[model samples]
Target: MSVRQLLYLAPIAAVLLASSSVVNGQDGVAEELVVLTDLAGLGRDENSVTYFKASNAGAYERFGESIALSADGTTLAVGAIFEDSSATGVGGDQADFSAPNAGAVYIFTRTGSNWSQQAYIKASNTGASDRFGLSVALSHDGDTLAVGALGEDSAATGINGDQHDNSIDNAGAAYIFTRENRTWSQQAYIKASNTGRIEEGDQFGYDVVLNGNGDTLAVSAISEDSAATGVGGEQDDDSAAEIGAVYVYSRDGADWSQQAYLKPRSFSTEMLIGGILFGFAIGMDESGNTLAISGFNEETNRGSIYVFERAGSDWFEQARLVASNPEIGDGLGSAIAVSADGNTIAAGAFDEDSALVGIVPSDQGIDDQRTDDAIGAAYVFVRRGDTWSQQAFIKPTNTQVNQHFGWTLALSLDGDTLAVGAHFENGGSTGINGDQRDTSAQDAGAAYVYSRSGTTWTPRAYVKASNTFARAEFGSSLALNDDGTVLAVGAPREADGAAGINGNQAADSAAESGAVYIY
Candidate 1:
């Protein structure tokens, strides 16, 4: 049996939804949670995946806001969006908290079963409130990395533009870094071609996705207001308010350039108040030939996803997808996952107000009623050739108001294993296979794992916090290893000030200090 040794500083409790026929001969049809530690690796246990403390973790650091694991699962990246350090490049003075909300990313590598922090990264400009590490992505080999700063204020547009200029307000930018011989350096600094200026608040790099090979990337500008549709459309058009747009780029010989600008054909007049998007629905396939971009129709209050395909040097829209049974305010595509081959997609509607429980038939549609408020739902879609169809409607076995079950999603390589996070879930369940019906804790959060055999889906595991405390919301962000054998969950609101294993779980000194767990 494999052992799972972890250094968990965050206190948390909660259980999320998952369904399926019993597999692996375990209770709840889920694999048992195993923990083991090596004598040599103590502070950061050998059996533990790396334990990240940001070298100088403090309250409101917001570490674990974003996380990514290399395809091989040897490397991990964690983002602390509220990190306050003026350090530039990597491994600089982390003790300097001169820049508030400047943000930072930590890189950790595993040798055998032991893990260690290797680098502390920050934006080149390192301006205050830039939020450089709010979003992050890693290449399959873990050599290429992308960091997003939605709060960056540079007016420059396109690749390698001027970095010193900060006339623009919250235009945002994305930085690419490559590793060679265990050394890292910035490759390029990217901004939207239609970069927003002062008062625009485009937030260009709100989300970033890198293809496995690290040659292609997709960046989302959450508040872009262009009414233009299709690739290479007019960039100056601001007729639409908060009309979102995505920028695609490719790398050749260390140089990067914009490939295409993407927007769904079913456009939105404006992004609504609940339109705050996470890294959920925006992604690229293994080769970056296929992509999924999501947006909400303000008029209909319904979210939709745009799937695109690349041909030679151009990109073409493949399909626009929505929930099988669409309902106003379902919040479909709030978070989404695409298979490595881009043939399978799981879209989460966190605000979906469904009263249903467990898995529903795929051929038929959902009940489409506002039976529960913010109960949440997720849909699975399969592609046969160029056509796509919904395969299953999933819900948690135990549902509660404002559980927000589909807040985040991760799909394993080859698309068989799937994990979902309900960070708002209130269940007070602890550890693996525990009772999920207990709802005493508020915002304790939970993670659920499911496996697929042929076309049938079944529950694989139920994961909860080891400390089982409220407000930790353990699964706020998730990353799965290539084959899905390893899972990493992040919680950005842990109050424990202590670091490392067996920390002071009762310490409430640090509020909003984050932590990550490997299972």
Candidate 2:
């Protein structure tokens, strides 16, 4: 067992061992929940294989080829990508031989000790290179699946009965597959009004997310026109490559149509500032109306997150987010996690000021110094009626400069609970109490949990994987299940800790694997 697995399983084991019920003769351990150590294998795949052990100590069953967990956790949907052998006239000469990847999706259900596949749905005319199943999202009930085929020939005509022909370029398309009477059907196929380009890494339709009722779907085009074109034309920011965007779609009953296109008003300016540009859709909310788009490499390498809201039936730009008091050179807001309600948001400023704490005062009196870039922090936001305001700024209780890269943030609904990952902290530095962050051998990964009580929030628990080390892996990604009871922290390149002992090994000398923490 690895340290990652032990951290998660130990709690459940302790709880079970205290009870006197014999559990399947497997150490009489009545498993409340079994936390899997590894979520993905080595390879650049974004989707994870879904698994579940229905009963305590039951066999682990692979639930689907590709699974997306719904926000409610009651249902899960599986998706697959299928290639269409014949797709001619749709996209000829312009379609490069090396440029198409297609895909499809499957749905599943969990009841008692049985996990079964529920539905199989595919995009029409899916073919090799379409990469359809590349991105998939499930509604809260698992009845709807949104799949993206960014490689589809956008120039084809009469889609969803519209006479408009698809545009050339990397015109991407998204399909909404709905389940009714236990039968699944393709409800609609959506394409951008202007999809003409052959950018290899355009990565169109890279991410897809759905609202609770499946009434809303947000699709991202990292390579889409950045100018926010109401009138069609390629608009360049002059500062960045491939301006990113999120499109919102709404469904009434069973009919769906494009409703809004969202991009930051001065997003072009934000990208062009430092001559280095970065943009992509890393995460989104349930409604798809609310999106969390990330951009770094901008001025000072400090990143920013943009939140878009759907007003009634139309999606529009809601607010722009950066470090509340952005540090001049601190690269904050690089990684983000937004709750389904959009009311709560967490942005990671992995490079914010940490060393100035001793020099600066408390939250009661704001710090005035403009140049403090040692430690990192995460910003939390709460939405008021029409706009959003900063609610709290968070840092590890014991944080140090260059060590606590408070790099990832995860917020639970109601914004009451938060989980932070500081991949670089060495125990014994500041409030961090492990030898992991030591110069010669930073030993392990640590995560902090905070809870909001009344108006003030307090750090409730600090967790560390026993055998972790410096550079074992950057604890860069984090996810919190709806209730915040289950926290999945990704240490993508972690090493296998002591055998049976499940703790730390010698620093810098271990194999790489990823660990997921369940609290």
Q: RMSD, each candidate, Å?
A: 6.4, 11.8
User: What TM-score, computed on C-alpha atoms, does each candidate reach?
Assistant: 0.88, 0.61
- What would the TM-score be for candidate 2 when compared with the true structure? 0.61
Candidate 1 lDDT, 132-223, residue by residue in tens: 88778899999999998988998999998999889888898999998898888899999999887477678788778999899999998877
lDDT at 344 for candidate 2?
A: 75
For candidate 2, which ten residues in a row score worst on lDDT? 10-19
The total number of steric clashes, by the backbone 3 Å criterion, in model 2 comes to 44
Q: Which candidate is the best by TM-score?
A: 1
Please list the C-alpha lDDT of all candidates, in the order they appear. 0.72, 0.48
The TM-score obtained by model 1 is 0.88
Q: Model 1 segments beyond 4 Å from truth? A: 1-51, 266-280, 297-299, 363-365, 500-506
CA shift of 418, model 1, Å: 0.6
